[model samples]
Target: MSTTPPRLTTASGIPVADHQNSLSAGRRGPLLLQDFHLIEKLQHFNRERIPERVVHAKGSGAYGSFTVTHDITRYTSAKLFAQVGQATETFVRFSTVGGERGSADTERDPRGFALRFYTEDGNWDLVGNNTPMFFIKDPIKFPDFVHTQKRDPQTNLKSAQMMWDFWSHAPESLHQVTMLFSDRGTPDGYRHMDGFGSHTYSLINAAGERVWVKWHLKTQQGIKNLMADEAARLAGTDPDHAQRDLFEAIARGDFPRWNVYIQVMTEAQADTWEQRTGWNPFDLTKVWPHADCPRIPVGVVTLNRNPDNYHAEVEQAAFSPANLVPGMGYSPDKMLQGRLFAYHDAQLYRVGTNHQHLPVNRARCPFHHQQRDGAMAIANGGAAPNYETVNAAGTAPSGFGHGDPGWALHGVAGRYDERGESDDFTQAGNLFRLMPPDAQDRLTTNIAHAMQHVSDDVQQLQIGHFTKADPAYGAAVRRKLADLREG
Candidate 1:
């Protein structure tokens, strides 16, 4: 066969004879108006960039394989975990949840560990944070919570007062606040920390049994966190340390991996819990107690290849808890329900409405949906009718298939307030009590360092919350902070 190259083509694959010479009057004159190909190329290039994510703005991604090492079919009907040794293609992105696009990776904040597993059945995304719980449980309070974490517009600086004010008023945030002030707040890097599906999910088995579940992706490298001083130093010296570390690790063939495990609870068991007795399981702020349902290891995920293009692969990647396959499903978790709408809404704003068409996020298997005609829509329904159950050609019939386990809802139609619960500080106190002396010392020092920057009233308010969690723990932090104030 001849070894010559094929004809050049436009992005749409239309053959182009001479791209070197623009359509012109006489060979050296002004360009003609008939340069459609040139115009299309330049226009597309000019609009290639979309807005970055508001949160998790700065991130890095890699391609990976998820291999099932243990059978979990009893828990989920998802084919990806149906059999031992089964493998699925996955794309994972690691990010800092609160910081801007240029924020330091080692900052004392939660990390986002979002993974998309493209299986034969469909796409399943586990969008979570390194910490198991959050600062607030109610979806209505989410925007307020985030606003506090962001910078103060008047000062154009991050406001610790804003953060503490929000946390102090929302007593339920104590558990997560305690975790955030601990060493775990400043993880050594993305690879050395554990990730948790903070929101509870529901998994249905082949037998149609439903169980509430929480996913944990334990870093195989083991948990490592930086001391407050060390983290501050690194943040100043190497702001992109975590992002660079992940990129360098994959490039050097030193792949990073995590062991996937899950803690599951039954509906009957959930009926007794104070929070879930009448609450939704999808709430993102509360975490299921591990003692009630211990974690069971299910599989291993190894990220082996870095994205060749950061903007194309990593920046364009979109993940949402709503991207569930057949076997895995959602719960009434209010926060989760809010995210179901929020994540996709954010994606539409940041990456255009047709972001799913991006190669990094497209399903591996063929996909069919009623979605049609949006900007950046690369794969137009392609001759297929956009409506279902239509007499038009290429229209497929629409009907409901399998649904979640049948459960009766006997509540009224009007909005109601959540029932009062006992102290939210108990679990946080337990976490503090469990920490070793050295870790506790580090936690106190870190809290003091952060609190010292805020007003004395805000500091007092935060210490009051801490004291409620554990007297001794609060006393230590107070003592350390008072010493700092005096000195």
Candidate 2:
């Protein structure tokens, strides 16, 4: 048996004699133009990095398995949840939203919890966030909201004034704004925070009965958060603290897990609940209280394997809400409807036209499609017909069944404002009141600290929204702002 390592070769399989040096006139003269190896190396290196995600740029991903723990077939006939012990291969990406690729992990920002389950049917991506609610209910305001979270145009720095100014104008942002300032905003790490499919989705049963659902991944590690001071210190000292923690934990066999739960609501129940509470079930800014729609245990997701190549497995990985299998479907959530198009389009631009052909994003199950001939087309349908056709017998081939259970749409096709139509302040107030006195104090203090750089008008306007939520909540924030400013 040969016990020698193989000789290095160029990309074209040509043996390489000198890899450390380029072909030069002498020792350090001008390089020869015939040095294809040198040119290949430099060119590949220059184009190695793809465009970073517009949001959720800094992320860590891992492979794992999702084991069904309880029966939910009555709600959805998704093959992944067919039995109590079924285990489906999974990959999860934890990210910091609104941060650049090199941003600190401990920044006070909403975390992205995007999960992909490779089931027998296909890959199902549950693209979500650590928080159950978002800052805006409508997708039209999303770009505007995200712009505020990013660098200011003139100064090229994050501006609290811009954030507060936007929030003050959009009362729908109150609930998420409140959550962002709370300790939950700066979670200890990815393992200690909960993940929620913030948009209301739908689950269709074998009987074709559809139900509105909200997905939740409750961390088994329990919720642990960092105070603002500690978070800031860690951000400066160890910018990759969370990424290191996750990688090290999995390496040492201390795998992290989250118990999956889903809150179900029937169509009739959704209508009645919306009328009773004066809240739209499809509103991205609100949450369906557990009291009204109880959570049902479904499965357990454990991240036991870290990616071998960060760029190949993690960076190129793309998850879209549009990736749905049978028994799962979409809803009327405006934000979700917008994402259905935006997510895939972004990946098409960022990861290339055939991003799905990448190993990390590929479905485990066998799939056949007429789509072919794109850049980096790994399979390219392998000589299969690229278009559907009817045979000489005048019969079409069997195709994938429709997964989405259609719903009725009854509304004027025009821009309808939802400002005074929804009760955004009540939920924000309810969340504030739910916290203990100490937690409430910390929340108020955090809000005050974040608002320090904002203008007085924005602060007062935001305080008024808080007042509408709860008098004490508003009063506490106002008092803390005064004390912090005075000090």
Q: Which candidate should be chosen as best, given TM-score against the real structure?
A: 2
Q: What is the RMSD of candidate 2?
A: 2.2
Q: What is the TM-score of each candidate against the true structure?
A: 0.88, 0.96
Worst 10 residues of 2 by lDDT: 395-404
Clashing pairs in 2: none
- Candidate 2 local lDDT, 47-80, one digit each (tens): 9999999999999999999999999999888888
Instruction: Name the TM-score of candidate 1.
Output: 0.88
Estimate the overall C-alpha local distance difference test score of candidate 1: 0.84
Task: Report lDDT per candidate.
Answer: 0.84, 0.92
**lDDT by residue (tens digit), candidate 1, 1-487:** 9999988888889898787778889978998778988788789899887776778888888999999999889888888998999999999999998898889988889899999999997788999999988877767888888888888989978888898888877877888888998989999988999988888888888777888899999999999999888999999999999989999999999999999999998887776666543334444556666676799999999999999999999988989888998778777677888899999899888888899989998889998988999797898898998988856575443221244565446677976555355457767888899899988898888888877878878788888878887898889989998899799
